[model samples]
Target: MTKSAAPSTEYPGLFSPHQEPLPGALDGELLYSWCARFHRLSGNSKASTTSQMLFGHATTGLRHDFPGQLGYFGAATGGHLGTLQEIVQARTQFALHALFLDESTRRATESVFQGNDRSQLSRTLGLSRSGQVSLTPLKACPACIGEDRGTVLTGWWRMDHQWPSMYACLKHRCLLNVMANQGRAHWLQEWYLPVELREDQWAEHTEMGQSQVERLIHIARWTEALLHQRDIYFDATLLRHVYLYQAKARGWMTWDGALRFATLRAAFADSHRGLEALPGWEFIKEVGSVNGGFLGLLLRKHPGRRHPLKHVLLMAFLYEEPLDFYAQYENSKLILETEGPAALDRRLTDMQSRLIEMVESEGKSANASCLELGIPTTQGLRLLTRKNVAVHRRPRILTDALKAELEALLRAGTERDEIARRLKLRKAYVKDYLATQPELRNAWEQAAKVQLAARYRAHFLRVLEDNPDVPIKRIRRIGGNGFEWLYRNDREWLAENLPGIWRRPET
Candidate 1:
């Protein structure tokens, strides 16, 4: 039988949010691209609407400006985009943090996904405040796009092609395209379909000769492998040791066990000969310089993270296979990373920085931040306060009855301090509230007179109702506060409403 047509309402996205299948995801499609697709489908005129709908607040810079805001994305959407299966795929299958970040950096960034409360989600790779990097260009594979069009699909950006130091596409064995006019952050401001192959543009970004082109392609494929091939995280220190040990064995390091900067730089230059046609090639060359220009940056004593491209390109030159690189790292005889008081000190310092960021930058509750960091409240709170990070607890809402009770206490001439203490509220807040409430002000002004009348009115009524024999003067005496004040303020009220026996004045 022929398949029946689905209902008109059976359409996806007819009722709620929808996401286009993440583009080029199997080969590392970026989360940022998926965010743009989601925004487009949302039909939101303002990009903030999409961000605010996903994240609790409307933060623009971190949303589209970077390739991944994994923690923030996971928190806001909770892995729900199209469906449960899609959520799993996008978060697990296509995630770059799991592959790119060093162990500590990955732990810090992925805290949000794991439901841990680290404030480092907004941070870019443990960079200091002064170390803000410029936004890199959004890159695309022109050949991939041209191929996609053959299947009637639009070209889209791929993560593997866009990474720093990746000069070509591993899949198509071709150099990637750069949209110079359209930078990374606002690329999603307008719809951007995948590009078709442009020979002129390709020539601009790539080298001409087959030999020069073939060499860069190897580096690109190696970078892609770095993103996907690793099943377990390797210690960056061990990796560094392995690289140095291999470099020494290959005679690429000095007799003093230092990186042979000139030789390595020469090799890098020789491999990608004439690639200066691509923008920023000079800077990469300078970083790879043998004069210790960026050598200390790549291999550090304490293990500072390097750009993924720097690690991959160096690995590409040093070893034929990624496994060979891993094998070298595994057999290294370097001191253990987790050892001694120095290690303890480093761990403590890292925790402090993470806590301060969580409370100060991420606006997490200080207590929750502490709990997530697995530290004690006393120590965490003390450290945060010492660093001048405000440990703000969530404000409790004032119930209507609390306001009424406060009004009552105020009317009864209770001290503001006593009222605050009794209600467990701030004195300033209570005072400010009373100043704003006209009803409370009115009650306060008439409280003395109201209390006087209330005292006399009850006694006066009981005498008339239950004891006709009781004297009116005695009833007035039993009422508290001054009888003269009541008489002067409420004489008419008393005279008109009292029983016949209590109606007349004693005089």
Candidate 2:
């Protein structure tokens, strides 16, 4: 509604008191987040109206947050805000900026990062729109919005959702809902509010395959990782090179180095089985053809920049990590292969890498690594004979001792939560571990009976013992309930334990 507001006549002349940006807001922030904060602090409504006085021209969209235009926001805010490099490193999704190979894109990005001249551009690097791929709806998580407002006092858009393969919130883990379907440029027409998202009207869940929720959790985490760290960056060309090389190693390529689509299809079908219904996943069918949908086009020299999520998924399927992919990509040309020494050397190198991966990468200890790798033993001496890898031999003595003590306690009728506390272990872990032990399992099965019988019997015995003069009838009356169960189930024990009970029970 505020879109038509003209700064020349309708609005205040200039932003007074040039406000400061939020504190500790470096890296991993969205452009829209700062803009919303900007308008709020400036005491204005529509940025389209207010920004004219600041940036010299009212602008919308990418002008607000991309690295090139960040200086304007800093200049208007009248504070010692960090440079555009810091802004891109911290705010805009510039970590993944290396994925675009177009030298023009690289140059434009460099222009912004260098903070040279703050010039506007027609296209954003790695930002997909109106080619093979369309822009995804702007995403907002209701839970995240509430969190940002309650803690930080604002609910701005996130760069995480803008990346490919991102469908859920990193914080809340619920699927993110999209904003208005029209141009996002309209978002700045008025003050943006968290309530504007209105997630109550959105879909409950996205289309997911079996165990996809768990899979998505890992993917979402990696997406954020990709956003923050500069450790992984490869354009489409290098990615294709990596994919084909890995595929070749796995026997998914022909003698002529062309992809054996049949092998790839079967393999992809097995791994990404239920995921075929996803947007890009649908393109897998075209692998054999020249124009192999998104997946096929990815292998081609220029497929017009597939989303980062696509690369992430492909990497997830093939490589241990981006580092591994990068290693192979860097090695393909240098490493000579044959059926002899070179091949054996590469094979050993690969095995050594795998060994390191089992221990360090997977964060598994020696025994665990040996067990997982199907090695005979985790002892360093034995492992040295097989492969040169250090196994973090976690001492099992403490764990064994804890288990033994917990089992003994469980068998003695201690409650699970109490046992966990006394042992400084988790209640769920105690329960699960207890279930694994024969003694504890048997004890758990009898816990109810033991609990009920012990409660009644202990009180009965205690009362009788404390007052030696007290009679069984008096104790039964004091016991209140469960006297019938004792009278019914343990008639013989009751007689033997309390001989006096037999003498006076007729009453």
Candidate 3:
């Protein structure tokens, strides 16, 4: 039967997310070619669209003015087009035009301002602080249309001079004294200047409050400075003082534990200087180490407790170390504790008992116990098979029609090959079947044994007959005494067993 189709979800995105695969679009060669092109283009330094070199005029030592430069600006009028030609003449003419226009516009704006009637000008034209008349461009230049076709130009007039004030404000001096002192006080002052704040309000605070805040800030600053020092003066001194105090109270802390806790505390505190610090194990160690102390008394009562406690301490160290180290240490500790001198003999005895139980319960031989301990299964099976008591049971061949046919064939004097072909059986099988019959099998065996003995006996007799003068003792010796032993044991029995072979000497 044909297999059922796989569920659609099993082939994710194959049919849905990307319809069926496009015949030629998914070609790997095409993708590789595109990738090559992209890499080449991206790495090319001389590509025109992204050239790194600057462009300038040699004579004037100024940036080169191209046709495209001012083409993006939309303010140039019909008269301004003529002014753009004649590079040197255009510059002078443009400056003159700007000066004349500025003076005229200034006079007009000043007359309006002195009139003190702001509503007339406000209705006709909005006046800015520096009173320059605003006019919208009737049409954009070709370059401006191409570059900014989709963009709004409402703030284009202010774009030229807008960045100057931002640059100036960057240099403005901050009035930080008005705020209360904070550690990194300059950072707070920088934050406050841009937002408008009254100086007088800051001066109204009591001098004592500011002094106290400054002193606290100074302390915080000093603490930070002490922490950053590599020589370890103040922090180490503080840790030593704390260490001595804990030691004096309980008199049990180890130097190593104290040093470890001090180091951990210093590193942790440095990262979180403004936060609360973690408690160390100095007190615990002190109590544990003191004579007649809580932990000390426990240890005194149980001398063996120190090893397990030390193992636990070592585990804590491993927990702080890498995972591989932790696993190695834990595994080693478990094996050590389980197989130590105190427990080795008992453990081995228990293992032997367990192995025996496993074999007995499973009805398997001792070899199966080796298999349970991860021995090769095939090797274990072979070992167990050798020990199997049932192996002595002889194979039983049942009498059937096939056996009767073979007997009939043997009675008819049929050749083994002819009998095998008639019964559609192998020659070996026919031979084996005939051999199972007691009378036929015994006759065949005796005949084969007699023939073998006769050949050797005939050779011996021929040697003796050829040399009649030879002594009987020497002749017998030459024939071998072992041959005589064989004749005495089986010669008469073989003659009686193979009467037909005796009658037909050739057979």
Work out the TM-score per prediction.
Answer: 0.50, 0.52, 0.14
Find the number of clashing residue pairs for candidate 1: 3
lDDT of 3 at 275: 18
How well does model 1 score by local distance difference test? 0.54
User: Quick one: ranking by TM-score, best first?
Assistant: 2, 1, 3
Candidate 3 lDDT: 0.30
How high is the CA lDDT of each candidate model? Answer: 0.54, 0.54, 0.30
Once fitted onto the true fold, the runs of candidate 1 whose alpha carbons sit more than 4 angstroms away are 1-15, 18-28, 44-48, 55-78, 81-104, 112-124, 129-132, 150-152, 183-188, 195-208, 254-260, 276-282, 287-290, 300-303, 333-507
lDDT ranking from best to worst?
Answer: 1, 2, 3
Clashing residue pair totals per candidate (backbone < 3 A): 3, 2, 2
lDDT of 1 at 290: 46
Q: Candidate 2 on 1-507: residue-level lDDT in tens?
A: 121122323324555332334444424456656556666766555666655644445653334234343455455444334655555555654555555435566556745543323333324454345232343445667787777776666666776665546666755767666555445544335545455445553434546754665455556655654454444346565566667667765667642345676667566556655554443345445444544445666666565666565677776666544445556755653443225334423332243455557666676555544433323243432544466554545443456777688777787777765675566444556667766777657877587467767776775566567656555545444422334446656666677887775575433
- Taking the tens digit of each residue's C-alpha lDDT, what string does model 3 give over 67-104? 11121111111122222222211221111112212344
After superposition on all C-alphas, the RMSD of every candidate to the true structure, in Å, is: 33.1, 19.7, 45.3
Ten-residue region with minimum lDDT total, candidate 1? 1-10
Candidate 1 lDDT, 1-507, residue by residue in tens: 111122222322422223433222333345555655565556778766665554323543133334233333443443344332233234232233345455565545433333222234335344333132444456777677777676635455666566556667755667667755444554435434355334432334443688766667766655545554445565556566666666665667643344566776676667756765665444454645545444556566665654444566667777765546755654452334436334432332357788888888898777666655545566777887788877876356778988789888888866665676677565566678778988876676577457647766664466456645555654433322233334656778766764475655552
Off by over 4 Å in 2: 1-13, 16-27, 61-68, 99-107, 112-135, 170-174, 183-188, 191-196, 200-205, 228-235, 262-290, 301-309, 333-507
